[model samples]
Target: MSPAVDVQHIAKAFGQFQAVREATFEVRFGEIFALLGPNGAGKSTTIRMILDIIRPDSGTIRVFGRPLDDAAKNQIGYLPEERGLYKSQKVLDMMTYLGTLKGLKPAESRKRAMSYLERLELADFAKKKVSDLSKGMQQKVQFAVTVMHEPRLLIIDEPFSGLDPVNRMVVKEWLYELRQKGSAIVMSTHQMNQVEEMADRLLMISRGQQRLYGEVQAIREQYAIHAIIVEGQGDWSRLDGVTQVESLNEQRRGAVRLHLRPEVSYDDVLAAIARDDSLTIERFERAVPSLDDIFIQVAEEDAQEVRWLNRREAEREVEKEAV
Candidate 1:
């Protein structure tokens, strides 16, 4: 089967400023695709283009194996970063109305909205006006409105923009449930921790260009440190083949991060540590870089590229004027 949504060679510009550059990615059924980038890096612009809210300078966007149309749109749910719930309208009523607007039958919309509110632990707030709900509750209510019709594809911007960790997890579980039910989910967020925990595939954009895109685990492995994190007794600094070691913590249970040289395989490091009877190996595991770390690395790399391009352009201007 074709991907739920396919975006190819998408480029968008505002006046002379290019907001997105040749972005290409696919969101498949039953997977959470994380669209990540710093602000103004074109993440939102690309999303808007995909939804047909704005026209792109060049590209093609396909939903359900064909160009997006009214019927195709009905199969997709979009929740923008800036929500617009009717404050004076009762929570359930507002959601049902929006669902109906999305082509869901009013009666079915009401039933599904109630089910979602109850699932999200907001059933008691159904009759309450949207203004009466807390910010997090309102967020969940908006989410309910988005998914009430059970769209086969979901596009969420800043899924957890607000709310404490406890409430964030509540919404996280609901997203997973949607994926389990065979929906393709694409979420854009600055919160790498949530992306690391929930996303299956990740696409990172920098300066409106594609930085990295692949399975989350593969990306982590590709950028993994040739090191191990160990929590042990006695000094690890003296271990042979260990190139560098950084102490992460030493209070409750001593933890140290180890970096290895090219010649030092993880097995070699472990064997050498084992040879030393004075050391007790508590926890020895490979260190995987977090999504936050990868994000910073990619962004810095792209920034350098941008700087180089600017310098080249300046040189060309000087050469042209000199001639």
Candidate 2:
């Protein structure tokens, strides 16, 4: 089957500012992909291009193997980060209108809207004006409208923002169920832990530059530094082949992380500990870096490099002027 969404070297700019620089990626059916970036990193601009809210300066975006058009729009759902609804309108009425705009018949729209309202536990507030609902309830109503038409591809920004833990779990589980049913989902959020939990794959951008992209676990393994997590009751810091030791258990008995030196194999560490015969070792496992760690590290490194480049250019200009 063709991919759910294909973005090929798409780029956008605002006058002198390049908003997106050759951003490219794909989302497959039955998968949840995370689009991660810091503020103004072009994630929003990229989404706008995909939705045709704004045209890309270069490259293309295809939805479900076809160029984005009315037909494609009908098969896509978008929950924008700037959550909006007609505050004065009744929840059911607003949803019904939006669903019909997506091409659903009026009767079907109301049916779908009401069904989603009931499923989302907002049935009691169906007739209430959106302004009467709390911020979280309004968000739920917006989500209901976004999905009432049953779009094949879903794009949501900051899906967990403003949601309490209970509601967050509710929405998270619903997205998982949708993906299981073959929906291609793209979520852009700053919640690394949430991404770690649900994202099958991820693409991270920094200042409109691609920093990382891959399966979540595989990306973590790439930056894992070949370390081993162990639980033992001896001087693991001084253990052979263990160049660096970090206490995972707060220096309590037996829980620590050992970083293997370049020339030392993980097997060497295990063998040396075994040969000691006095250490009470319990657990030995490979360590994986967390997404949060990788995100911060990559973004900072990118920023530092950009700063260094700017400084070098400024120095060159100064020297040329003197000459």
Candidate 3:
């Protein structure tokens, strides 16, 4: 089957500055795909172009085997970076109106709107004006509107920006539920932890270029540290390539975080440590790079590339002016 969304060789610019450069990726059906990058990395521009909010200067976007069209648009839902609501409008009325715009009728919209409100614990605030709700409450209301139409593809940008931890969890759970129901989600966020927890796959972009895109677990494995943490009794201090060994707690128990030598095997480490029969083993597990580390490494590498490009551009400018 075709991907739920696909962007190939997409590029966009504003006047003289390119916002996105040859960005490309695909979002599989029924999976949560995350776009992670720092600010000004062309995330918003790429998203806008994909949604047809802004036409790409060059490239193609396909949704479900067809180009972006009214049918595709109707099948997708979007929650933007900036939240907006009619301050004077009742929560239910506002959401119902937005839902209606998606082709839902008054009765159907109200039914789904109330169901979402109840599920989000916002049922009590149905009659209240948007302005009366707290920031988090308002966010939930906006979320309700985003899903009221039951779109197959959901694109949410910074969905957790203003949410408190409690509400954040609420939203997170709802997103997972949507994925289980076969919704294709393309979300952009700075919260690496959330991406790690929720995203099945991710695309990392910098300066509108794709830096990394793959299954989350596979990417983590690609950058995996071939190391292990041993929590047991052994004089690991003398172990070779063991970069750091710190005490866990009492003298009888300690943990060693090892950075193995290229030729050494984990089995060798365990065998050496097990020599001391008196030493008790507590925990032994391989160390893997966290999502934060991967994100930082990718972003830092991209920043370095951008700096190099800027320097090259500067040199070209000076050479031209010299002539």
Candidate 4:
């Protein structure tokens, strides 16, 4: 079967400012696809184009193997970053109304609304006005409304905003359940940790450009450095082929990151450490960078390039004025 969302070289611009230069990716069923980028990096614009809220300047977007149409719209559920709910309305009533808007019958909408509220631990606040609930509670209610109709494609922006750790886990489990039920979820958030936990594949944009796009684990491995993290009682710095040893903790009794020479194989280092009777190895693994590390590295690189481009443009303008 075709992927749930297929965007092919879609580009969009507002006047001379290019919001999305070229974004191409596929979100498959039963997978959470993460859209990542720094602020003003065109993630929102790309999402708008995909949802047909804004048309792309070039290329195309297909939802479930066909061009997005009214029918396709019905199959999509969008939870924008901006929260919009009737503050004066009771939580259950508001959720029910939103569900009906998604094509659920009033009775079914009410039923599902209550069911979701219960699942989200907000059933006690069902009769309370939306404004009466805490921000986190309101966020949960909004989430309940978003999924009450159970669309095939769910697009959520900053889904964990205002949520505490406990509530965050609740929402995470809900998304996983939706994925298991064959819903394709596209999550756009700045929470790198959450994305690392939930997303299967990801597309990262930088200054309207597609910078990285691939399976999450594969991408992490692709950016892996030649190092090892060892936690044990040993003088790691004495190991041959180890260029540097950095302690991971303040007390110096915790794990140490051993930077290896390029020519030295990990196996050789492991063997050498094993031969040293003075060392007691408790844990040993490759030093893989986390998603947060990768995100910051890419963002910093993009910012440097942008600064260089701006300077070059300034020089050209000065030359023209001089002429």
Candidate 5:
């Protein structure tokens, strides 16, 4: 089957600067895909193009095997980086109104909106004016409006922003529930830990280009460092392939992070430790770099691309002056 959403070689430019360049990827059904990048990485611009809020200068976007259009719009739900709602309107009324725009009738919208509000613990605040609610409360209402119509695809940009830890957990759980119901979701967020927690796959872009896009585990494996922590009295420094080792604790009771020579074998290292009768193995495990580490690695890789481009531009300018 075709993917839930697919964009092939999409490019968007503004004047002399390209905001997105040859970006290509797809979101599989029933998986949470994350778009991760720093500010000005064209994440929002790319999302807008996907939603047809802004047409791409070049390339195609297909939703459910059909080209993007009005009918396809109803198949996708979008929660933008910026929140939009009528401040003076009653909470339930505003939510229902927005839902109605997505093809839900007023009665059906109200029923769905109220059900969500009550589940979100905002039923008592249903009649209250949106302006009277706190920022967090309004955010929850916005979330309600976005999902009430039950689109097959959800595009959420920074869904965890401005949410407290408790509320963040609530929203995270709700997102998983949506996925459990077979909705494909693409979430854009800077919170690496949260992305690692929820995303099944990741598409990282930097400076208008794709840096890394693949299964999260695969991406992590690609950047794995050959290092491990050994928690014992063993003098890891004497082991073959041991590049360096520092006492992890002043009391000599903590694990050490060993930097290994690329050619060293795990068996050789273990053999060395085994010879140390005084050493008692408390824990021995390979070091697995976290998502944050992977993010930094990929971002740096993209930054180098940007630097190379800048150098070529500078050289062209110098050649022009010589001419």
Candidate 6:
């Protein structure tokens, strides 16, 4: 089957500010595709273009192998970063109304709305006004409404906003279930840990430019440092081929991170540790950088490049004035 969303070289700008620059990617069925970027990095603009909320300045977007139209729009469900609901309306009533707007009959919409409320542990709040619910509860109600119609493609921004850990897991499980049922999910969030746990593939944008795009694990491996994390009692700094050793705990008694020389393989380091009788080895493995680490690294790199470009431009203007 064709991907649920295919965006090719799409660019959008507001006045003189370019919000998205030649962004391109695909969201396939039965998978969670993460849209990652820092604030004002054009993620919202790109999503708007895909939803046809705003027309792109250039490039093409195909929803399910065809240009996005009324039918295509119906197949997409969007949960924006900002919540929108009738605050004065009761929870169940508002949800049911939203469901009908998505094409379900009144009875079916009400049934599904009630079922979702119960599943999300908000059944008791059915009669409560939307404004009376807590922020997290309101968030759940919005999510329930978004998926009640079971759109083929779901675009959710910060889906776990205001949610505690327990509720967060509930939403995560729901997304997994949707993916298993062949719904293409596009999640945009700043939570790197959640992204690492849930996303199959990701597209990261920096300064409105596509910085990284690939399978989550592949991208992590690409940014992996040549280091090992050892959890045991040992003088890791004494090990041969270990360039540096840093404590991974506050007490300095739990795990130590060993930075290895490029030429030394993991096996070689393991052998060295084994040879030292004083060292007690409990857990040893390669130290993989987390998504948070990668995100900061990429953002810092981009910022540094921008500063350099600004400096070059300033120098050019100075030279022109002198001439």
Count of steric clashes across candidates, in order:
0, 1, 0, 0, 0, 0
**Per-residue C-alpha lDDT of model 4 across residues 122-158, encoded as one tens digit per residue:** 8899999999999988888888877888989999998
Q: Highest TM-score: which candidate?
A: 6
User: 1-323, model 2: which lDDT tens digit per residue?
Assistant: 98998989988889999888877789999999999988999888888888989999899889899889898899899999999899999998989999999999999999988889898899999999999999999888887787777789999999989989999888888898899899999999898999999999999988887778889999998998878988868888778777788887445665788888889888888888888867778888888878988999998898899999999999999999999
TM-score of each: 0.91, 0.93, 0.89, 0.92, 0.90, 0.95
Give the worst 10-residue stretch by lDDT in candidate 4: 246-255
Error of 2 at 278 (Å): 5.6
119-185 in candidate 3: lDDT tens per residue? Answer: 9888999999999999889988888888888788999999899999889889888888889999899
Model 4 residue runs over 4 Å out of place are 246-254, 314-323
Quote model 3's TM-score. 0.89
lDDT against the true structure, per candidate, is 0.90, 0.89, 0.86, 0.91, 0.87, 0.91
> Which residue segments of model 6 deviate by more than 4 Å?
246-254
Which lDDT tens digits does candidate 1 get at residues 229-275?
99879888899877788888547468888888877899988898889
After superposition on all C-alphas, the RMSD of every candidate to the true structure, in Å, is 2.4, 2.2, 3.5, 2.1, 3.0, 1.7
Q: Superposing every Cα of model 1 onto the true structure, what RMSD results?
A: 2.4
lDDT of 5: 0.87
Which candidate do you rate higher for TM-score, 2 or 6? Answer: 6
Model 6 — TM-score against the truth? 0.95
lDDT of 5 by residue, 1-323 (tens): 88989999999999899999879999988999999888999999999998988989999999888788787787788999998789999999988988888989899999999999998899999999999999998888888788888888999999999888888888899999999998999999999888878899999998888888999888877877787778866556667688888556535577787888888877777777787776678887776667888878778877787799999999999999999
Any runs in candidate 5 off by more than 4 Å, and if so which?
Answer: 231-235, 246-256, 277-283, 308-323
